[model samples]
Target chain A: MIKKRFILNFPPDSGDKPFSYHLVKDYDIRINILKAEVYPGKRGSLLLELQGKKDNIEKGVEYLNKQNIICESLDKRIHFKEEKCIDCGNCTAVCFAGSLTMNRDSWKLEFDKEKCVVCELCIPACPLHLFEIDFR
Target chain B: MQKTKTYEEINLKLKSGKAVILTAEEVAKMALECSPEDILEKVDVVTTATFGAMCSSGAIINFGHASPPIRMEKIRLNGVPCYEGLAAVDSYIGATACDPDNPSYGGAHVIQDLLEGKDVLLEAWGKGTDCYPRKHIRTKINISTINEFTLFNPRNAYQNYNVAVNSTKKMIHTYMGTLLPNLRNATYSTSGELSPLLNDPGFRTIGLGTRIFLGGTQGFVVWPGTQFNTSKPKNEYGIPVSNSATIAVMGNLKEMSPEYLQAAYYDKYGVSLFVGIGIPIPILDVEMARRVSVNNSQIETSVLDYGTEGTPKLGQVTYSELQSGTIKIGGQKIRTAPVSSLSKARKIAGELKKWLQNGDFEITKPVQMFPKNTSLKSLKETEADND
Candidate 1:
């Protein structure tokens, strides 16, 4: 059970209520609105918990981008280095889920679009800091 | 079977232009969601001591670096960079060989040791002086007889050799007999004396003049008891019958029991009897090995007291001498002595020091190094190609 928390911010009275309403109705997500009485002179905050497939969650994030939520973020980030990588199959071999691969007759490494769970198991194998996860 | 897909087929978007930053918790969660295959598409390299797979040796492996990285990653999902030098060196070699972009550097800890004045064969033994008490006892018997004639006898003769001699002898041994006991008896006693006592063997034997020695036995007892309460009884009411406990407690009381007590002392003032257990030999060996390896030197045979019973004494051989194989311990030249000796050990130290210097030599070469900067354009082009 992987759980992630994200803080999404919106402009005050941007008329984005319809978008929020549509997301909750379509995606079956739970949302809580912060009451103005508890937090004086503050714009409303909506707490959301979305449970489903990772790809779907990503799609929801993309939807937020489409909805123009500027300060949208997940608790983690996936990082990679461009210069140090050699398309070696070592990381692929270590990855149990078959997340990494090497191009035939070439020194290029490849990652599966749908199969990656972002475990960062390959980060230590790459001594040049080619792979990393930023949870801050 | 799915034909082994080329790196390009995995993903084109992850060409190394952008950075992905995720917290440890987030990474773990993401890892759980995606399969290893899915992860391969986003990044060109993977690094960790533990690969999350069960079959692997669990040692850290570095894929992209030419030389071992200064800092190695830990076997954890927390995303903290833990450093394990030896594992890092080995893993760097493993990863470089597989990756085309990075060139391999042959592993070189042994070479490093040579630079630090360590001999290869004798390198296993550490450098230090140790003294241990060695006791030996022997018993022998001789018999003589004299004959005298009385007044009634016509001829009197004094026969010393020809007369019959009746002799009865009894020997009572102490340490090796009652206190230490022979190999079989020792084992039987330590383990429960069951029908198949042979199956679970213990001590070898206790010889004559073998009193409880201080250094080896006492040192072993103190650390473990302090850390985990291994040999000590569960409570103050419980008494320790084993010799190991008695020796450790008494030794500490004489030498530095106060130091150990001060370190573990709690702020609350109260009169309480603390029962502690002593550390085991193997555990001490492992910790010593780790410490020695980190220090970039091997331990000497003398430190471990190869021949002596239970004390640390000055060793005859110096670190340089043992590397050349002049000193011998336990029938073999002291190649790598553990930390337990290094003091009071003599003949073994000389042989060990000589062997170490002879075997301590090394050389190094650069295989392949990482490129300076790989642009996103190149990465995209590489990913587009099937080959």
Candidate 2:
């Protein structure tokens, strides 16, 4: 299965429509709404992770474009260079979103991609330069 | 106090490969199953460590003389300003010293870069004397090329400290990292139970001339740090409930590494140094082992509201409460964040333990004890003309 993240921008009027529900019902795609600020009569945004067959993901994007809801695919995400990481957990101190955390038992660093907000705060906090922004 | 183990006994055990070593945190955990006497009998030494932002820390470097030599006056390293008030070629780089033109990088960063073996741009303009003719020099130097590099920190390892939070609507950056305003978040720095000063509390085993593991090397406690408050109120443990004491530490900067000595910046809070320090608390007896086994729940500190101009102390809270990642203030649940990396603290403690077992490092008894009941007073102006 192919997965992609996107920043969905909605026109003020389109905020009233249900985009995610339709994407799942019509396109047979799995939707994970990472963040959503869409409100009725407001120009808002929705961050989503869409997963499905490659053809279905493309068709879903085509549908979003036809509705004038600008959907931009995101390429930026936090990537941990495990080899360089010493499991120091310095990155966890600044990761307000709980993206990086230490395993209590093993005392090793555990990274959760979905929880990361791409704040780049961890980039400078790490002494070994183990964290990077992966554009994929 | 129960028959405390002598310092010599502990050393002998370590030398003979029969000594049992444990980190402060481990001792705290063992406290549940083992009594103080049992622990004292089994453990010879308990290693303590802390990694946190220390603003009053810096290094004094004696770069030796250049060809012919010049009386160095103005000096800067890696764009960070350095104090040239020392002798001819000696320079003191302060932890809070930031890049002269840009505020992003600071002296702490420069020191870390030096430890990383990076070539730093050293620019100095000195007065040319008859004997020392050179006037100005711009050179790239690394830690290995320097003659003498000393980590002479005036204050470090605060016994206990305040948890920082903001009372205002806007966020404020501090040496403690970002404090979300309106009690939204709190930031704390100490390694809590694993900290050196916290484990020893009363300086029974730790004092002036005490050998320590500092920045990945053996170091010493030179003196009591600035702003030390030995008069603070103590709990049943004979330790203060808030920040009380600190140590002036000295170590060879050449033997340090970037892993333990890090450069950090807290956004608008400016530059501060993250010092890695480990103190081996000798299980001198049951009393010492019991002291070392103190847990975060037993240790407490104040939570200060930093958004206010006065930075008033909000209330007293235990490290256990802070470590749980949240605390209630004014009936609202506030998220807590750690400024010090306990993971790094644990790493330092483990490293120090290996050094001791492998016979690479040894502990030293204090030549002189730290001052007890000492008072810190501010300078006052005298009335001369009126009198």
Candidate 3:
């Protein structure tokens, strides 16, 4: 079994498709929707965490592609500018997922992308504007 | 009182490269395991530092007179308006002043650009005078071309500050950083034990004319900072429980480094300068030794709610608890973060320690001491009538 996070972008006209239904019913995958935004006529996006067998997860992505839904991995979604960062720890304050932290011994800021929930709080909380979100 | 070391003796040791120096973090740990006398015997100076967004900071610059000079009445540097009340070609560019077109970049960035030897566009509008008839002048200036550039901060190196939190339903943007609504998070700014003012809580060694490390260069404390409060309540460790004891510092801006100074922008709160400051405390006696030994657990600050009309006191938390990344406030476990950079502060302390160990930097006795009693006053509103 494996757990992975992905961002699913739905084509403007493809919102009627039962993407979550097919993934859960056919692929036997567990869906945890971290964030979702649905517009009436505009394109919509879903930030989801999928937990299932490796093969099933791969099959689910194929299904998403067939439905014209763009699915991308959640990794590298957050960009931390290290050189610009003063290692001030302001980003660590609003990081509820504990993805951003200070190494107590070295007193340096460290980022673990896997643990980020894409809350986007650190983007503005940073005084130096070091944290950036790359949704594309 | 008999002294363990004097300024003269420390100077001799520093000059001879025999003086022992320790960062405040190192000394704090040493004091935990060693006696006061042992600390005094082993250490000559304890270096303290803090790097945080000091909003009340700026530079006083004298752009050398133009070939056809004018009584400069208005000026803007890199599109950011500068204070033009000074003499011709002399202006004060404040850190918070930003270009109307670009809010993110401000006066601080201009100063950093100048320090990096980058030419900045200088535009001025002058009133045509008999002796100086140029009405408008446009030019570019760098640090080398400027006759004098001084980093004159009216208030900085805060002894202690507030832990900002948002208790209301809406999120708040403040200089303390963005606060999550419903007490979701708390943010603070201070170096705690390694802070200059905290290490010398009584302003004993830190006063007017005291030599300090400002932005990777030597600076002096020119005066007690604006809003220098002394009537605040103190903890058992004698550290102020709130924002107190600030120092106004002056240094040659040309001598500063970009690595030690930075321009910071909050989401909606605007621009501020991250100032790196370090002060070395001479171990003159056992009492001073003990003061430098005060650790994070012993230093506490009030957690004030910023979502209200005025900041309402929520409670207090120690630096140890805050640094733990979470603190229990109002029975809820709220995550915490610091606006100040401990890593940068540590670097400043280490750098200052190296300067002292190499005998390149000498600690000076304050020419004058700050007053022990001073009160902070608030501006009162008055109704105006046409006379």
Which candidate has the highest TM-score of all?
3
**How should the candidates be ordered by DockQ, best one leading?**
3, 2, 1
Give the runs in model 2 whose Cα sits over 4 Å from its true position: A1-4, A8-46, A49-55, A61-75, A79-97, A100-109, A117-136, B378-387
Q: Provide chain B's TM-score, model 3.
A: 0.97
Choose the strongest candidate by lDDT. 3
List the candidate 3 regions with Cα displacement exceeding 4 Å: A25-28, B1-3, B384-387
lDDT of 2 by residue, B1-387 (tens): 347778887788788888899999999999988999999888888899988878889999887788978888889897788998987899999988987567768888888888888999998887888887889988999988998889989999999888888999986767676665678778787888899998888789898899999998999999999998899888887778878899999999999877888776666567878899999999887788789989989988888898998889888788888878688877788777676778889999999899878767677899998888886786676877753
- Candidate 2: clashing pairs of residues: B4-B284, B4-B285, B5-B284, B5-B285
lDDT of 3 by residue, A1-136 (tens): 9998888888799988888999999999999998888886888878889999999999999999998999888874656778888988878877888889888767688888767778889888887777777653
Two-chain complex of model 3, DockQ on C-alpha atoms against the true structure: 0.73
Candidate structures ordered by lDDT, highest first: 3, 2, 1
lDDT of 3 by residue, B1-387 (tens): 345789999999999999999999999998889977888888889999999999999999999888788777989899999999998888999999998779988998898889899999999997788888999988888899999999999999998999999999998899988888999989989988899999999988888999999999999999999999988999998999999989999999888999999988888889999999999999998888889988999999999999998899999999999888789998999888888999999999999999998999989999999999998879766757734
lDDT tens readout by residue for model 1, B125-190: 112123211121111111111011000101010000000001113211111111111111110011
TM-score of 1: 0.19
TM-score on B-chain, cand. 1:
0.13
Q: Higher TM-score: candidate 1 or 3?
A: 3
Q: Candidates 1 and 2: which is better by TM-score?
A: 2
